[model samples]
Target: MPRWTHYGSVEELMSNPLQHLCDISKKAQQHSITQNGMEEAMDYLHKLHIGDTLVTSTWKTLFAAYRAELAKLFNRIGVTLDITSNELPFGRQDLTTPIHSEILTHFLSTSEDRLDLSSSNLGTPRLHRTVASPKPLLVDLTSTLSNLKTYSRVIRIAPEKQQFTYAQHNHIVSKILSSRPTPTLLPKMETLLIAPVTDLTPLDGVLSLHTIFDQSKQHMLKFARDPNADEDTSKSETFDPVETADKLGVNAITFQILQSKRNKLLKFEWKRVMSDVRDPGVFVSYLYARLCGCVLFLSSSLSMI
Candidate 1:
């Protein structure tokens, strides 16, 4: 008999949904699990707006990192997997209707644990027919996340170079970060949210509010640090929590307000910024003025087919 090593069986790969999802791309357990650019992912996700069905493909540079595993898993599952060498998931025929085919049904029927069910990717319904590919803004955002080094936050440093003024602060935060930032996906944005702790600063509810401020959900760490602050934030919570949260800063209430408001603001911001891209460059820094999720997303979710 010719010397031959047996190819692995599909028992685990085919039977389990979670396993199948993970195995969908076989290089690793979650090969296709996007190692999104934390900031970029946020931007792209915003552009997508919530409630939109993401049309991606296993044939782009971004997907190159996860392609093999996906192919293996699909092969194991007995689906005809046709994708490009790069492995991105966008602008392909697979995204078309049939909404009922085997693979199509599998994807449509599967309830994504990580998928934000907040309506559209940007959190609202978009009127477009299909998402286009090679959306540079989305790609750039992904690249930014893939290159993350450390968590970047905006804190009030002790009167650096220029004198402090709201215009300057706005200019500094907005102008400086207009271009997409690069690095690993930032899972915890709270870690990057900080302000200078000065002697004059009162250790009131604002002291450690971002962590605890929960209009809907309680953030234990923040509450433990300062239990007294919650009283004021509860009243401010509303449909437009971002503005309320921003004005209040990152207190327990503000943080909670943020948690509730983030999806909404991201959606609004995404729509406002992506509607035309008349300026073209505006998309890169759409979230320069955003509250959070401004820089964190998969490095590749663009396609125009």
Candidate 2:
């Protein structure tokens, strides 16, 4: 008798829509399920069929991370974090949809504050090939639950047919994200929206205002930490490649060092100043000028020699 260890059973794999969605891949399609098989697996999940325990293990893991990140982003931007739902429901109910609208609403925004839903074009009907399609807003409640990581997983699994087209995914995600009610501030009303970037790495499109600010702050701090950086350019020689190039009338400078070793030097002229290279900072501006001057003097001396 041969002992057999089964991985995921067909029914077991099919029960979890997110897992199935994540498993979608050309290889998976070829080896286990076809493209249509995956599609059928996904279509089996309808919002109506969803029970109280609609959230999946995948949802629990990913949503936890998502909420944590969002909380940090909100905190950084001076926004209060309010989550009404402490526990997300999950189970063996075999719901086709990954999550329900109620759960999505909880995830989106649970506050009573209502923005004029009228301003939102969610009321707009989707058109398909000159015929109006069903209200995607009504059907796409679960769409916003996916993120770049999950999308990447989907692509990794099945590249051909996806539940949502790139544009469709973005659009649905954008709608769900933007549906969150804006906090009302007395005297002045302000809103912050984080745009999702298509770039797979570094949470490209999903970066919040605070995340961007924090990144910029870190970059500035990194530069600040360097003692020999712009702040202390006393030792740095100034070399305005542009001016030197103009004076020499060439894009590149190729010359031999006047020392006995006779080292050859070939370098391109620096056409852009530091300020031009990056956004202007007081220290950078001054340091760049000093560096340019040093370079020019060096070039002039070398030319004379």
Candidate 3:
């Protein structure tokens, strides 16, 4: 069953909204589908699609993990997928998508609504997806934070098979560059790396975003090597998360939205770049650039040749 939105002739749909669909048509689009060396881990997922789940009696799997990665790469490179791929969710159903619950709940509690949902009211943690009158309330807060700290969660698909929210974490990267600093003896190098997030880790904790940003630089470095191995990077780089939400957390819906946007390319910060490699460890990872509606991912991967 196709959700049909009338497009003029056979080619009209590709020209709509952003003209991105047209862009992807002109591109070769074959970069994110590489197979990882065999390991007992998640190698198979490197080939799965996000939405197209494979159904079995007991469980399911997305066809190819690399598929979505391909999609994300296409997005980053300004390739608009075919018009069909951008279709809205729950096609043709009266039940269109809605606002994010976690954000709405926060607004409800603190805004004009004045209602609060506590853990006691949320009950057991499963969504029936059954619509109720005046809307069923989102449950209360399970945890409270007074200071910054690390956190983690492991989720189960059914009675078992837990998925660990391991490295996917977030935190407040406070004012880093404004403090006192000593002068360097020489100049440094830099480069910008952007990765579209096609997925989200459903967990909660105050995480130092630097953790993931640092990890990504290493991953990229594995693929891209610099000739100048001894260049300084400490003062020659910056890794800024474009979307700066003080309270960084998302429920299922908002969480998924975060991922969807991550796959889309948008121009982000248009600041000056350092043309040298000063410190690889000081590179910025623009993880939330998509979430913040950025069109370009700008970073200074400053390393000399």
Candidate 4:
């Protein structure tokens, strides 16, 4: 049951290398053989005629010609075949030989009139298999003013309230910065150290301090700005400070304090929370000693009392 496209001689095989391969593939199918098995059979046949110099020379020529035609066909279709592997070039390695044979048969049987040569059909031009790496996410302090301006447009506040908010924001930010041992170095620091409000007793008010911190942390992390993002894109990506402030039920100064601290805060990872230190309080104390050298205070009252 070997299906044969019987070429009279090596000359006929060299003349129609693709057709000969197709015929061999069909013959391989009858024996329930794979592409790899078919390749071995072809190599065995080649070795049988190796003693005859003319036949050997003709086979080398035929193989070279077959490879060239395959390359040309793939190039025309905008595919770069990995011809180094003995497997079919068009599809995945897991695909059966029969599927590969069908692909080849369909491609070869297609008429010129039926073939679509449009860019959409051919797909976009791609570089030689190079994948782009993702951009790093970093804070863009430069866009802070622009972000504030965007925040202003989304909320309706009186001129006096707006001015007071700005003053309050600045004052809290100044206190937070000034409290740091190296106050000048805080602005230059690339990343913020954020921790959960473990000691929530101090700020407990109408709303739980822990709840407010968690909400603010979630909001801050959700819209964390990319330093490299374009201006137009950043403009559209708004994190309304007013809305965040309202949610926390904080006044202008407290809202500013949270905003300033939140900006410097890094995304907290649970994996990193576990430490070798015997006491968690000791770790917190160490961080405080290293960063601020003093306890940062917060008041529940909106009006400074």
Predictions in order: lDDT: 0.25, 0.26, 0.21, 0.30
lDDT of 4 at 274: 24
Error of 1 at 66 (Å): 14
Put down candidate 3 lDDT per residue, 69-154, tens digits, no spaces: 22332333222322122121101111111212222232234333221121122222221121244210111001111111312211
lDDT digits (tens) for residues 1-305 of candidate 4: 12232423343333223444545545555667764565554554343221111111122233333333333222332333332223221222222234333433433343431223322223222221222641111111111212222211111112222222334434433433343343333442112212122222322122223333444444334434442243333344443332222222222224433333223222222122223232223222222111110011122111221
What is the alpha-carbon lDDT for the whole of candidate 3? 0.21
Q: What is residue 70's positional error in candidate 4, in angstroms? A: 5.8
Q: Which candidate wins on TM-score?
A: 3
After superposition, candidate 2 runs with Cα above 4 Å error:
1-57, 83-276, 280-305
How would the candidate models be sorted by TM-score, starting from the highest? Answer: 3, 2, 4, 1
True lDDT of residue 34, candidate 1: 50
- lDDT tens per residue, model 1, 35-78: 33222322333342311222222223222212332332223212
| Cα lDDT of model 2 by residue, 1-305, tens digit | 11111323333332233333333322343467544543343334333221111212233333332233223223322333233322211122222233332223434453452112222311222211122343322123222222112211100111111122334333322333333343221101111111212322323222122222223323333433442444434445433322222212111111111110221221211222221334323323222222221222223222221
- Candidate 2 worst ten-residue window by lDDT: 251-260
Q: Residue 47, candidate 2: how far off, in angstroms?
A: 35
Candidate 1 lDDT at 281 equals 37
Off by over 4 Å in 4: 1-8, 34-37, 44-101, 104-305
Report lDDT (Cα) of residue 71, candidate 4.
35
Task: For model 4, state the Cα shift of residue 235 in Å.
Answer: 51
Flag clash pairs in model 4.
Answer: 192-264
Q: Could you tell me how far off, in angstroms, the CA of residue 162 lies in candidate 4 after the best superposition?
A: 85
